[model samples]
Target: MEPSDLAGMALIAAAGPEEALAFIRAGVSSSPVLEVEMTSLLSEAGTARWPGLADALGRWRPRLPSLAPERDMGVMERLGGGLLIPEDPQWPPALDDLQLNAPIALWMRGQLPRIPEQRRCIALVGSRDSTSYGANVTGELASSLVQRGFTVVSGGAYGIDANAHRGALAAAAGGGASPSTLAVMAGGLDRFYPPGNEGLLRAIAEQGALVAEVPPGTNPTRYRFLQRNRLIAALCEVTVVVEARWRSGALNTAHHAEGLSRSVGAVPGSVYSANSAGCHRLLREGAAVCVTDAAEIAELAGSAGNNLAQEPDAATALHDGLGVEDLLLLDALPLRSATSAEKLSVVAGLGMATVLAGLGRLELMGLARRATNGWQRGAV
Candidate 1:
């Protein structure tokens, strides 16, 4: 197909994805008018938005005739993903704040989550090589945030990102209208990066959404990871750093949040912990708010006196009479990944028969789910 006839993402990319203002300034708009504006942007006078616009669009002009979007779309569709441009109804208005750096289009898998308000989309980022303390804190924070009706957003990588995603999924398993989490991937949705996070990424796509700027087949390079951080920051009103060191990439995300004029929150770690140095730095520099829990995070992102997390009723009927072994088993069970009966026996300090029996009971009550991979923590 001709470049003008190309899909929204390809047309925008070829027109000038790198030069954020080129197409918008040329009045290249909605899905219906993208093709027509291809010529509009190419015309001599239309490149006046920026000095480089003319050269940028000019360079793509000849190559437009040879562009092929149909093939790409076929591949994307086979993967159950499609393109998203600013004109799309599901487009997050918060991203427009990026202004000159806004992405031309997004390659996404699954539905884009729509929180009640823009600020309801909260981002949690932190050190990739995190401590057990950091991971536990991050998971609790992420799970609590989602339970409060806010959608958690994070990069789909190791450490903090993985825990954040797992925590969100764990909350979702309880079965309510709480918003689903979103993962803005550094690479293409066609594949998961870090290799280890494949299952978590897949669950997020099935339960929430996953998005990327580049098309399918793109590798996750270091530069791309940095670029993706901007999207994570811009997509949310509040970005929280659960834990980070002096040179952690999570700090980069906090900087992007500050640059975009979004709220930044830092979770304090042990005074001498190297993993928490970056958060301390942000707090010391007064670049981030000291947020110790999900409620504080919600307050920072939400408006005055609203968007409050639903306090669990103290006298609720759920789990009123569970035995000690059941409680311990619940605590030891994982939220997303599976584990074996023997592993559960060891972790919960129960016999194999006891672990197996509890797994069966929890599974029946929707408190636990089973897979050979392991026993999953069920919602209480």
Candidate 2:
């Protein structure tokens, strides 16, 4: 509720981000100064002291009733979130690279983890009408990246974005020190957009973070959606488009990422799928490298060394490699004592034929062996 924040909200509501930055550049002094002296400043507009300020200030004057500080504060209080400024520790320094386009203040809900110096954040974006292939790939990549301790950042939309967030949530529940995912919203935090995604957005707010550049009460517009893409790009070290139609909004995010010099990646899709046209275009233009999984994306996000391979742990590796039935049969046949096939079947909840087949596979793989007692798990 500070004067500066109020001033920023007013300017943003009035002249939009680009014009607000113009006002700031033209020696507006401070937000409070602008708020109080706006009339005088406008009266003297087109003069040397306030050149190029008239148009924006003129636009701001009429919108004062709805854009005032008191109204914004009420929405903030109702939403139960706080405002983040440049001085605040949680304010992403990456955004400052946007220079004047950087938000003056961010309306935020939920918590953000301590972003590491190397920027272990990756963005997962794609078409709103994504295919199952894209959703499957996005979920796999997002969860895997979380397992590798990278945070996933995405716009809180349907299709690929929802899958990415869901994957991160699943990974976090498995228990680890990985940071939570983030969703950048185009509209005010007070009104979650895409009404269908209310449950998912609420869950994300509970488990991760929800961020918006505009103040409360602002509904999303096409212009705002395109503008918000910049925030999504600036928040992470890498931005990936999993699926995009030609001229999709995700392409906008990729452009922002490229402008920031952040790594850009695209998930390849079927040649005929329209959903992948944008990604294919990016790949063809050399705007993005073809990325398929977490390891490749991890390298782009600055994870160096030959460390992408899982660490050597024979027992764990063997366990991980087993099929469900094979694993169950292996567990049924204890390491020290072999058990009968019928007993193993009952314990593994598999049919007798399935148990026999699984036992044969395990025996062939050296994970189980036939003994006088019937079958026993392989020795470590």
In terms of TM-score, the best-performing candidate is 2
For residues 55-104, what per-residue lDDT tens digits would candidate 2 score against the true structure? 44454445544555567777776766778877778677898776546667
* Model 1 local distance difference test score: 0.78
Model 1 Cα lDDT, one tens digit per residue, 1-380:
11112233334544555343345445332333544454444343233333243444455455455445677677789878888878789787887776545676688886544423567788999988989999999989988888878888999999999999888888867666454789998877888888999999988888888988877767788888898999999998899999999888999999999998899999999999999999999999999999898988988887768656566567765555678888788778889898888888998999988888887877877789876766787665
Residue 40 displacement in candidate 1 (angstroms): 17
* Most lDDT-accurate candidate: 2
lDDT of 2 at 275: 95
